[model samples]
Target: MRGGVNMSGWAGFSDEELRRMQRKGAEQRPAESGSCPAPGPRKAASSAPRSRQQLQRERALQQAAQRSRAAGEEALQAGQQLSEPPPERTSPGAPEQTAGPGAPSPRPEVKQSPAAESEESREEAPEVKELDRQEAEEVLRTRLQVLQQQQSLMEEQNRVKKDLLTRTLQLKSQQTQAEAAMLKTVRAELQQLETMATNDISILRGRIEEADWEYSKARKRYERAEAEFVSSKLDLHRKAELKEHLAEHLYAIIQQKELRKARKLEELMLRLALREEEREAGPAVETQLEAENVETVKEADFEKEAGTEEGAGSKKEAESPEL
Candidate 1:
């Protein structure tokens, strides 16, 4: 039969009551066994051995608790795995053993020893804290990895944006330069065409002015020539009329000279008859007849000279423009 109390009976007990019960049982064990009066040598020998054994057990338990506490502290600071095994939980139905039958029975108010309960609690507490530290460390590591991945992705996006911006600026600059060159070329061509048109207009205007001057000069020359021709025609008509009048006068003078010649011839015939009759009469009658013949010839020559001068003067007037 087990000489002990049940662990279920210790569940509702306070620590002070349990410790008081343990002291009472320890004091009563030696007296009830009648071994308290053992011979001095034997008692000294047995008590020394028992005291050493109890001290060893107590030191062992304290060392175990300290090691567990230290291990838990180190695990919390460094996130390392626990090397010690997990603590075992005591069942409430299990029995607790006493040293002998002479030991005092426990009081109704006492159930379990305070030292054992404390050792169990001390061992179990570290295990719980270590598990919690491990979970927290795992969560922190996961969050750090996610943050690093996001930073790398953002850097890549920025690089792509910068490259596109640079390309756009280059294309814009090239287009602007091309437009400027095209505009310059067009302006130059327009200026050249305008200059050519101006020159052509100037030449045409000069040619027209020269043509007008030549036409005016020709008209003036034509007018002067016409005036000269009209004056010459009028002079010619006047000269023709003067020539007709001079011809009529010359014909009348010639007829009168011919009649005078016929009359002189008849008078010469009468003088010749008279000369034949007076030839036998005397020499003085012949000399007076010769003198009369010379006087009549002189008168006829003077009249012929006057008529020739008038005819020559009329011919000169008819031929000259001054008439």
Candidate 2:
């Protein structure tokens, strides 16, 4: 039973198995290292700080791997001890003797009671139980080591995930900072444009004021010229009215002079008719006619002189300078 237990314990995991597992681990290490590349110089320069929980977890994984390796070593040692031949056993009553290689040693036979046999069997039972327990413990240890290895692998995967998350967050923060800088630049440009626009508006307003002032001045000058023209037109209208009145009064005076000359000639004709009726009155009548004719000619000459004087006065008035 003890040998069976020993064989079973050894069978649970042998040296070959340990070597195979170790070789597998060794082969995977390079691939794992290659898959998870080391940080570059630039990445190292901006390396993020690890959290307390992450550091603690990494430390725990390392401790578990160490423990698993130690357990594997102990199991290997146990298997080696089981594989070695058991030490030679001798009864307390017998003594060790040296024998030549060509001769055989003689042995004594002894009889055993049922009680003695039973006692021996009873003692062997606990030894068998102990071997079985030891085998079970070894099996459990191997299983625990496997579990630990699986746990370590899972921890590595989690670490990689954390690293990726950290890198993504860092990139996002950098992008946000860049955007903020661009926004600041845009705002500055907008402020500069607004300042330039304000300056231009001020300049335009000044020009508009100047134009308005010039327009007001021109309007005033036009108003003054229009007033002077209106006064001149009024003066011309008054002169025209005065000339019409003078022309009408001169025409009336000439008509009255013509009527008076016609009346004087009719009186002279009546005096000639009376002188022909008496011969004694001929010379007196002829002398009176001559006097009348002379008076008529003298009055006509005076009227002509008056008309010439009036014409000269009217001509002088018409040529006079403006007030």
Highest TM-score among the candidates is held by which one?
Answer: 2
Question: Which residue runs of candidate 1 sit more than 4 Å off their true CA positions?
Answer: 1-187, 273-323
**TM-score for model 1?**
0.36
* Model 2 misplaced stretches (Cα beyond 4 Å): 1-151, 257-323
Per-candidate TM-scores read: 0.36, 0.39
* lDDT (Cα) of model 2: 0.54
Superposed by TM-score, candidate 1 places the C-alpha of residue 235 at a distance from the truth, in angstroms, of 1.0
Q: 233 in model 1: Cα distance from truth in Å?
A: 1.7
- lDDT of candidate 1 over 1-323, digit per residue (tens): 11122222111212343344345445544444553333654444355555543443333333323333444344455565445433333322234323222222211222457777676544333333323333234324433544465567778888888898899899999999999999999999999999999999999999999999998998899889887788788777777777677677668767866776667656666666677576754654565567467756866686778678777876676567653
For residues 100-213, could you state the per-residue lDDT of candidate 2 as single tens digits? Answer: 222222232254666765664443332323233343445457656655766797899999999999999999999999999999999999999999999999999999999999
